[model samples]
Target: MIGVLVTFTQTDKFDRSTLAKIAGELRGPFEGMAGLRFKSFMLDEDGVQARNFYMWDDDEKGRSFFTEELVDKVTGIYGVPPKIEYLDIVGFVDNSGT
Candidate 1:
Protein backbone atom coordinates (compact mmCIF):
# COMPACT_ATOMS: atom_id res chain seq x y z
CA MET A 1 0.00 0.00 0.00
CA ILE A 2 0.97 3.63 -0.43
CA GLY A 3 0.15 6.73 1.54
CA VAL A 4 -0.05 10.12 -0.08
CA LEU A 5 -0.02 13.35 1.81
CA VAL A 6 -1.02 16.44 -0.11
CA THR A 7 -0.72 19.68 1.74
CA PHE A 8 -1.99 23.05 0.62
CA THR A 9 -0.36 25.84 2.52
CA GLN A 10 -1.47 29.47 2.25
CA THR A 11 -5.01 28.43 3.01
CA ASP A 12 -5.57 31.77 4.71
CA LYS A 13 -6.65 33.01 1.31
CA PHE A 14 -9.84 31.02 1.71
CA ASP A 15 -12.10 30.91 4.72
CA ARG A 16 -12.98 27.63 6.39
CA SER A 17 -16.47 27.66 4.96
CA THR A 18 -15.12 28.12 1.46
CA LEU A 19 -12.61 25.34 1.90
CA ALA A 20 -15.24 23.03 3.25
CA LYS A 21 -17.51 23.87 0.37
CA ILE A 22 -14.78 23.04 -2.09
CA ALA A 23 -14.08 19.76 -0.40
CA GLY A 24 -17.76 18.88 -0.37
CA GLU A 25 -18.03 19.61 -4.08
CA LEU A 26 -14.96 17.58 -4.91
CA ARG A 27 -15.91 14.56 -2.84
CA GLY A 28 -18.26 12.91 -5.28
CA PRO A 29 -15.70 12.20 -7.97
CA PHE A 30 -13.48 10.17 -5.68
CA GLU A 31 -16.20 7.88 -4.39
CA GLY A 32 -15.47 4.27 -5.38
CA MET A 33 -12.36 5.31 -7.30
CA ALA A 34 -10.23 2.40 -8.41
CA GLY A 35 -7.11 1.56 -6.39
CA LEU A 36 -8.05 4.03 -3.67
CA ARG A 37 -8.40 2.49 -0.26
CA PHE A 38 -9.29 5.65 1.58
CA LYS A 39 -9.14 9.43 1.45
CA SER A 40 -9.65 12.20 3.94
CA PHE A 41 -9.88 15.95 3.58
CA MET A 42 -8.46 17.84 6.49
CA LEU A 43 -8.22 21.49 7.33
CA ASP A 44 -6.07 23.40 9.79
CA GLU A 45 -7.59 26.82 10.08
CA ASP A 46 -5.24 27.85 12.87
CA GLY A 47 -2.21 26.75 10.86
CA VAL A 48 -3.57 28.14 7.60
CA GLN A 49 -3.28 24.87 5.77
CA ALA A 50 -5.38 22.21 4.14
CA ARG A 51 -4.08 18.65 3.94
CA ASN A 52 -5.52 15.64 2.17
CA PHE A 53 -4.44 12.10 2.94
CA TYR A 54 -4.90 9.27 0.49
CA MET A 55 -4.30 5.56 0.85
CA TRP A 56 -3.88 3.69 -2.40
CA ASP A 57 -3.38 0.04 -3.24
CA ASP A 58 0.09 0.66 -4.68
CA ASP A 59 2.76 3.27 -5.22
CA GLU A 60 2.41 3.34 -8.99
CA LYS A 61 -1.26 4.27 -8.88
CA GLY A 62 -0.64 6.86 -6.21
CA ARG A 63 2.27 8.39 -8.10
CA SER A 64 0.41 8.35 -11.38
CA PHE A 65 -2.50 10.26 -9.88
CA PHE A 66 -0.42 13.21 -8.79
CA THR A 67 0.94 14.42 -12.10
CA GLU A 68 2.07 17.88 -13.12
CA GLU A 69 -1.34 18.46 -14.61
CA LEU A 70 -2.98 17.58 -11.31
CA VAL A 71 -0.69 20.03 -9.55
CA ASP A 72 -1.62 22.76 -11.97
CA LYS A 73 -5.30 21.96 -11.68
CA VAL A 74 -5.25 21.99 -7.90
CA THR A 75 -3.20 25.15 -7.92
CA GLY A 76 -6.03 26.79 -9.78
CA ILE A 77 -8.58 25.28 -7.40
CA TYR A 78 -6.94 26.29 -4.13
CA GLY A 79 -5.08 29.32 -5.45
CA VAL A 80 -1.78 27.70 -4.47
CA PRO A 81 0.33 24.71 -5.36
CA PRO A 82 0.35 21.63 -3.11
CA LYS A 83 3.24 19.84 -1.47
CA ILE A 84 2.81 16.16 -2.22
CA GLU A 85 4.61 13.38 -0.36
CA TYR A 86 4.48 9.66 -0.98
CA LEU A 87 5.15 7.11 1.74
CA ASP A 88 5.25 3.35 1.89
CA ILE A 89 2.63 1.81 4.11
CA VAL A 90 4.20 -0.49 6.64
CA GLY A 91 0.92 -1.52 8.23
CA PHE A 92 -2.76 -0.66 8.29
CA VAL A 93 -5.80 -1.29 10.44
CA ASP A 94 -9.40 -0.94 9.36
CA ASN A 95 -12.13 -1.30 11.95
CA SER A 96 -14.98 0.25 10.04
CA GLY A 97 -17.28 -2.66 10.73
CA THR A 98 -16.67 -2.74 14.42
Candidate 2:
Protein backbone atom coordinates (compact mmCIF):
# COMPACT_ATOMS: atom_id res chain seq x y z
CA MET A 1 0.00 0.00 0.00
CA ILE A 2 0.99 3.59 -0.45
CA GLY A 3 0.49 6.30 2.13
CA VAL A 4 0.09 9.99 1.46
CA LEU A 5 0.17 12.75 4.02
CA VAL A 6 -1.18 16.16 3.11
CA THR A 7 -0.89 18.96 5.60
CA PHE A 8 -2.50 22.40 5.47
CA THR A 9 -0.76 24.92 7.63
CA GLN A 10 -1.49 28.53 8.45
CA THR A 11 -0.02 31.25 10.62
CA ASP A 12 -3.41 31.79 12.20
CA LYS A 13 -5.28 29.00 13.91
CA PHE A 14 -8.70 27.77 12.96
CA ASP A 15 -11.56 27.26 15.38
CA ARG A 16 -13.19 23.90 15.94
CA SER A 17 -16.28 24.77 13.92
CA THR A 18 -14.18 25.82 10.96
CA LEU A 19 -12.13 22.66 11.22
CA ALA A 20 -15.29 20.59 11.36
CA LYS A 21 -16.62 22.36 8.28
CA ILE A 22 -13.38 21.73 6.44
CA ALA A 23 -13.50 18.07 7.37
CA GLY A 24 -17.10 17.94 6.23
CA GLU A 25 -16.17 19.54 2.94
CA LEU A 26 -13.38 17.01 2.51
CA ARG A 27 -15.60 13.94 2.71
CA GLY A 28 -17.51 14.47 -0.52
CA PRO A 29 -14.57 14.23 -2.93
CA PHE A 30 -13.43 10.82 -1.74
CA GLU A 31 -16.84 9.17 -1.83
CA GLY A 32 -16.09 7.11 -4.94
CA MET A 33 -12.38 7.65 -5.39
CA ALA A 34 -10.63 4.72 -7.04
CA GLY A 35 -7.80 2.85 -5.33
CA LEU A 36 -8.59 4.42 -2.01
CA ARG A 37 -8.24 2.28 1.07
CA PHE A 38 -9.05 4.82 3.75
CA LYS A 39 -8.57 8.41 4.82
CA SER A 40 -8.08 9.89 8.30
CA PHE A 41 -8.27 13.51 9.22
CA MET A 42 -5.97 15.00 11.85
CA LEU A 43 -5.42 18.23 13.69
CA ASP A 44 -2.35 19.62 15.37
CA GLU A 45 -2.32 20.45 19.06
CA ASP A 46 -1.76 24.10 18.24
CA GLY A 47 -4.69 24.06 15.82
CA VAL A 48 -2.63 25.76 13.15
CA GLN A 49 -2.34 22.65 11.03
CA ALA A 50 -4.69 20.08 9.63
CA ARG A 51 -3.71 16.84 7.93
CA ASN A 52 -5.21 14.13 5.83
CA PHE A 53 -3.69 10.66 5.95
CA TYR A 54 -4.63 8.48 3.02
CA MET A 55 -3.91 4.87 2.21
CA TRP A 56 -4.20 3.76 -1.38
CA ASP A 57 -3.78 0.64 -3.44
CA ASP A 58 -2.34 2.54 -6.40
CA ASP A 59 0.47 5.03 -5.92
CA GLU A 60 -0.16 6.86 -9.16
CA LYS A 61 -3.83 7.45 -8.41
CA GLY A 62 -3.03 8.61 -4.91
CA ARG A 63 -0.21 10.87 -6.00
CA SER A 64 -2.08 12.38 -8.90
CA PHE A 65 -5.23 13.12 -6.94
CA PHE A 66 -3.86 16.43 -5.79
CA THR A 67 -4.22 18.29 -9.04
CA GLU A 68 -3.57 22.01 -9.38
CA GLU A 69 -7.27 22.79 -9.20
CA LEU A 70 -7.68 20.68 -6.11
CA VAL A 71 -4.70 22.38 -4.55
CA ASP A 72 -6.21 25.72 -5.37
CA LYS A 73 -9.48 24.67 -3.78
CA VAL A 74 -7.74 23.61 -0.61
CA THR A 75 -5.72 26.79 -0.62
CA GLY A 76 -8.89 28.77 -1.03
CA ILE A 77 -10.60 26.94 1.79
CA TYR A 78 -7.81 26.96 4.34
CA GLY A 79 -5.99 29.98 3.01
CA VAL A 80 -2.79 27.98 2.86
CA PRO A 81 -1.19 25.69 0.37
CA PRO A 82 -0.67 22.09 1.40
CA LYS A 83 2.55 20.16 1.79
CA ILE A 84 2.24 16.62 0.50
CA GLU A 85 4.45 13.65 1.18
CA TYR A 86 4.35 10.08 -0.08
CA LEU A 87 5.39 7.16 2.10
CA ASP A 88 5.97 3.47 1.64
CA ILE A 89 4.06 1.46 4.19
CA VAL A 90 6.46 -1.06 5.65
CA GLY A 91 4.07 -2.44 8.24
CA PHE A 92 0.86 -1.71 10.10
CA VAL A 93 -0.25 -2.55 13.60
CA ASP A 94 -3.96 -2.78 14.31
CA ASN A 95 -4.89 -2.95 17.95
CA SER A 96 -8.63 -2.58 17.45
CA GLY A 97 -9.15 -6.24 18.26
CA THR A 98 -7.41 -5.91 21.54
Candidate 3:
Protein backbone atom coordinates (compact mmCIF):
# COMPACT_ATOMS: atom_id res chain seq x y z
CA MET A 1 0.00 0.00 0.00
CA ILE A 2 1.15 3.50 -0.77
CA GLY A 3 0.00 6.53 1.14
CA VAL A 4 -0.02 10.20 0.27
CA LEU A 5 -0.94 12.99 2.63
CA VAL A 6 -1.43 16.62 1.70
CA THR A 7 -1.95 19.73 3.75
CA PHE A 8 -3.60 22.90 2.46
CA THR A 9 -3.34 26.11 4.35
CA GLN A 10 -5.01 29.31 3.30
CA THR A 11 -3.11 32.50 2.78
CA ASP A 12 -3.98 35.68 4.68
CA LYS A 13 -6.54 36.45 1.98
CA PHE A 14 -8.49 33.20 1.69
CA ASP A 15 -11.50 31.70 3.43
CA ARG A 16 -12.46 28.17 4.49
CA SER A 17 -15.78 28.08 2.65
CA THR A 18 -14.02 28.74 -0.60
CA LEU A 19 -11.45 26.07 0.09
CA ALA A 20 -14.13 23.54 0.92
CA LYS A 21 -15.81 23.79 -2.47
CA ILE A 22 -12.50 23.08 -4.15
CA ALA A 23 -12.15 20.00 -1.99
CA GLY A 24 -15.69 18.82 -2.67
CA GLU A 25 -15.08 18.97 -6.41
CA LEU A 26 -12.25 16.48 -6.08
CA ARG A 27 -14.28 13.72 -4.45
CA GLY A 28 -15.84 12.17 -7.54
CA PRO A 29 -12.75 11.69 -9.66
CA PHE A 30 -10.52 10.67 -6.77
CA GLU A 31 -12.97 8.11 -5.49
CA GLY A 32 -13.23 6.69 -8.98
CA MET A 33 -9.48 6.53 -9.56
CA ALA A 34 -8.06 3.18 -10.62
CA GLY A 35 -5.50 2.45 -7.90
CA LEU A 36 -6.87 4.60 -5.12
CA ARG A 37 -7.72 2.43 -2.13
CA PHE A 38 -8.97 5.01 0.33
CA LYS A 39 -9.42 8.75 0.41
CA SER A 40 -10.45 11.01 3.25
CA PHE A 41 -10.50 14.73 4.01
CA MET A 42 -10.69 16.82 7.14
CA LEU A 43 -10.67 20.42 8.23
CA ASP A 44 -9.11 21.82 11.38
CA GLU A 45 -10.18 25.32 12.29
CA ASP A 46 -7.79 25.75 15.21
CA GLY A 47 -4.92 24.49 13.10
CA VAL A 48 -6.19 26.46 10.09
CA GLN A 49 -5.66 23.50 7.81
CA ALA A 50 -7.29 21.18 5.35
CA ARG A 51 -5.90 17.66 5.05
CA ASN A 52 -6.22 14.81 2.62
CA PHE A 53 -5.17 11.23 3.24
CA TYR A 54 -5.16 8.89 0.27
CA MET A 55 -3.93 5.38 -0.35
CA TRP A 56 -3.08 4.03 -3.74
CA ASP A 57 -1.97 0.62 -4.95
CA ASP A 58 0.31 2.08 -7.61
CA ASP A 59 2.81 4.85 -7.08
CA GLU A 60 2.75 6.09 -10.65
CA LYS A 61 -0.98 6.62 -10.60
CA GLY A 62 -0.63 8.51 -7.37
CA ARG A 63 2.15 10.73 -8.69
CA SER A 64 0.30 11.50 -11.88
CA PHE A 65 -3.07 12.32 -10.43
CA PHE A 66 -2.52 16.04 -10.23
CA THR A 67 -3.08 16.55 -13.96
CA GLU A 68 -4.01 19.79 -15.61
CA GLU A 69 -7.59 18.59 -15.77
CA LEU A 70 -7.70 17.97 -12.04
CA VAL A 71 -5.87 21.19 -11.37
CA ASP A 72 -8.40 23.07 -13.43
CA LYS A 73 -11.19 21.23 -11.72
CA VAL A 74 -9.89 22.50 -8.40
CA THR A 75 -8.28 25.82 -9.24
CA GLY A 76 -11.32 26.88 -11.18
CA ILE A 77 -13.37 26.46 -8.06
CA TYR A 78 -10.94 28.07 -5.69
CA GLY A 79 -10.78 31.83 -5.45
CA VAL A 80 -7.01 31.63 -5.33
CA PRO A 81 -4.23 29.10 -5.59
CA PRO A 82 -3.54 27.17 -2.40
CA LYS A 83 -0.22 26.34 -0.84
CA ILE A 84 0.06 22.57 -0.80
CA GLU A 85 2.52 20.41 1.10
CA TYR A 86 2.95 16.76 0.14
CA LEU A 87 3.88 14.10 2.63
CA ASP A 88 4.76 10.49 3.31
CA ILE A 89 3.32 8.85 6.39
CA VAL A 90 5.31 6.44 8.51
CA GLY A 91 2.32 5.21 10.51
CA PHE A 92 -1.43 5.64 11.27
CA VAL A 93 -4.48 4.02 12.86
CA ASP A 94 -8.16 3.71 11.90
CA ASN A 95 -9.42 4.08 15.48
CA SER A 96 -12.71 2.51 14.30
CA GLY A 97 -14.71 4.23 16.99
CA THR A 98 -12.90 2.21 19.64
Candidate 4:
Protein backbone atom coordinates (compact mmCIF):
# COMPACT_ATOMS: atom_id res chain seq x y z
CA MET A 1 0.00 0.00 0.00
CA ILE A 2 1.00 3.61 -0.46
CA GLY A 3 -0.13 6.90 0.96
CA VAL A 4 -0.46 9.99 -1.17
CA LEU A 5 -0.92 13.39 0.41
CA VAL A 6 -1.80 16.45 -1.64
CA THR A 7 -1.96 19.80 0.12
CA PHE A 8 -3.35 23.00 -1.27
CA THR A 9 -2.58 26.39 0.23
CA GLN A 10 -5.60 28.61 0.52
CA THR A 11 -5.92 32.12 -0.89
CA ASP A 12 -8.70 32.78 1.61
CA LYS A 13 -10.49 31.17 4.50
CA PHE A 14 -13.75 29.32 3.95
CA ASP A 15 -16.65 29.10 6.30
CA ARG A 16 -17.91 25.69 7.44
CA SER A 17 -20.84 25.61 5.06
CA THR A 18 -18.69 26.60 2.11
CA LEU A 19 -16.10 24.02 3.01
CA ALA A 20 -18.74 21.30 3.22
CA LYS A 21 -20.01 22.30 -0.19
CA ILE A 22 -16.54 22.16 -1.64
CA ALA A 23 -15.99 18.71 -0.15
CA GLY A 24 -19.27 17.52 -1.60
CA GLU A 25 -18.37 18.85 -5.02
CA LEU A 26 -14.99 17.20 -4.95
CA ARG A 27 -16.22 13.78 -3.81
CA GLY A 28 -17.77 12.77 -7.10
CA PRO A 29 -14.50 12.92 -9.00
CA PHE A 30 -12.91 10.33 -6.74
CA GLU A 31 -15.65 7.77 -6.76
CA GLY A 32 -14.68 4.41 -8.26
CA MET A 33 -11.25 5.68 -9.28
CA ALA A 34 -8.81 2.98 -10.32
CA GLY A 35 -6.14 1.87 -7.88
CA LEU A 36 -7.67 3.94 -5.12
CA ARG A 37 -8.16 2.27 -1.77
CA PHE A 38 -9.82 5.30 -0.21
CA LYS A 39 -9.49 9.04 0.32
CA SER A 40 -9.96 11.49 3.17
CA PHE A 41 -10.42 15.22 2.65
CA MET A 42 -9.22 17.50 5.40
CA LEU A 43 -8.90 21.16 6.33
CA ASP A 44 -6.78 22.89 8.91
CA GLU A 45 -8.45 24.54 11.93
CA ASP A 46 -7.43 27.95 10.62
CA GLY A 47 -8.78 27.04 7.16
CA VAL A 48 -5.60 28.19 5.47
CA GLN A 49 -5.04 24.81 3.80
CA ALA A 50 -6.87 21.81 2.45
CA ARG A 51 -5.51 18.35 1.94
CA ASN A 52 -6.49 15.07 0.36
CA PHE A 53 -5.09 11.89 1.78
CA TYR A 54 -5.32 8.97 -0.64
CA MET A 55 -4.53 5.38 0.14
CA TRP A 56 -3.51 3.43 -2.95
CA ASP A 57 -3.03 -0.21 -3.71
CA ASP A 58 -0.13 0.73 -5.91
CA ASP A 59 2.44 3.48 -5.65
CA GLU A 60 2.70 4.06 -9.41
CA LYS A 61 -1.01 4.76 -9.65
CA GLY A 62 -0.76 7.25 -6.81
CA ARG A 63 2.17 8.98 -8.52
CA SER A 64 0.42 9.04 -11.88
CA PHE A 65 -2.71 10.64 -10.46
CA PHE A 66 -0.90 13.87 -9.57
CA THR A 67 -0.25 15.00 -13.13
CA GLU A 68 -0.04 18.52 -14.44
CA GLU A 69 -3.62 18.39 -15.62
CA LEU A 70 -4.79 17.39 -12.14
CA VAL A 71 -2.77 20.23 -10.70
CA ASP A 72 -4.43 22.63 -13.12
CA LYS A 73 -7.85 21.33 -12.16
CA VAL A 74 -7.14 21.68 -8.43
CA THR A 75 -5.75 25.16 -8.98
CA GLY A 76 -8.86 26.07 -10.91
CA ILE A 77 -11.03 24.93 -8.03
CA TYR A 78 -8.95 26.16 -5.06
CA GLY A 79 -6.92 29.00 -6.61
CA VAL A 80 -3.59 27.49 -5.66
CA PRO A 81 -1.23 24.85 -6.94
CA PRO A 82 -1.05 21.70 -4.81
CA LYS A 83 2.01 20.14 -3.24
CA ILE A 84 1.93 16.34 -3.60
CA GLU A 85 3.89 13.81 -1.63
CA TYR A 86 3.95 10.01 -1.83
CA LEU A 87 4.95 7.80 1.06
CA ASP A 88 5.25 4.11 1.79
CA ILE A 89 2.67 2.67 4.15
CA VAL A 90 4.68 1.12 6.93
CA GLY A 91 1.63 0.12 8.94
CA PHE A 92 -2.02 0.91 9.50
CA VAL A 93 -4.32 0.70 12.49
CA ASP A 94 -8.05 0.73 11.92
CA ASN A 95 -10.41 0.24 14.86
CA SER A 96 -13.37 2.35 13.99
CA GLY A 97 -15.93 -0.44 14.41
CA THR A 98 -14.63 -1.45 17.80
Best by TM-score: 1
- How far in Å is the alpha carbon of 63 misplaced in model 3? 0.3
Candidate 3 segments whose C-alpha is farther than 4 A from its true place = 12-26, 83-98
Over the stretch 12-48, how does candidate 2's per-residue lDDT look in tens digits?
8867688788788879978778899888888899999
By lDDT, the candidates rank as 1, 2, 4, 3
lDDT of 4: 0.85
- List the pairs of residues colliding in candidate 4: none
- Output candidate 1 Cα RMSD: 1.5
State the lDDT of candidate 3 residue by residue for 2-83, as single tens digits.
6766555555534667556766776787667789878887667564666677776777777687667765654555433444
Q: Report every candidate's CA lDDT.
A: 0.89, 0.86, 0.64, 0.85
TM-score of 4: 0.86
Q: How far does residue 25 in candidate 1 sit from its true spot (Å)?
A: 0.8
Candidate 1 per-residue lDDT, tens place, 1-98, comes to 99999988982555778878988999998999999998998887575788899999978999999989999999999888999999999999899989
Error of 3 at 92 (Å): 6.4
TM-score, predicted candidate 1 vs. hidden true structure = 0.92
Stretches of candidate 2 exceeding 4 Å from the true structure: 94-98
TM-score, each model? 0.92, 0.86, 0.59, 0.86
Query: Which candidate number would show the highest lDDT if scored against the true structure?
Result: 1
48: Cα error in model 2, Å: 1.0
- Superior candidate under TM-score, 3 versus 4: 4
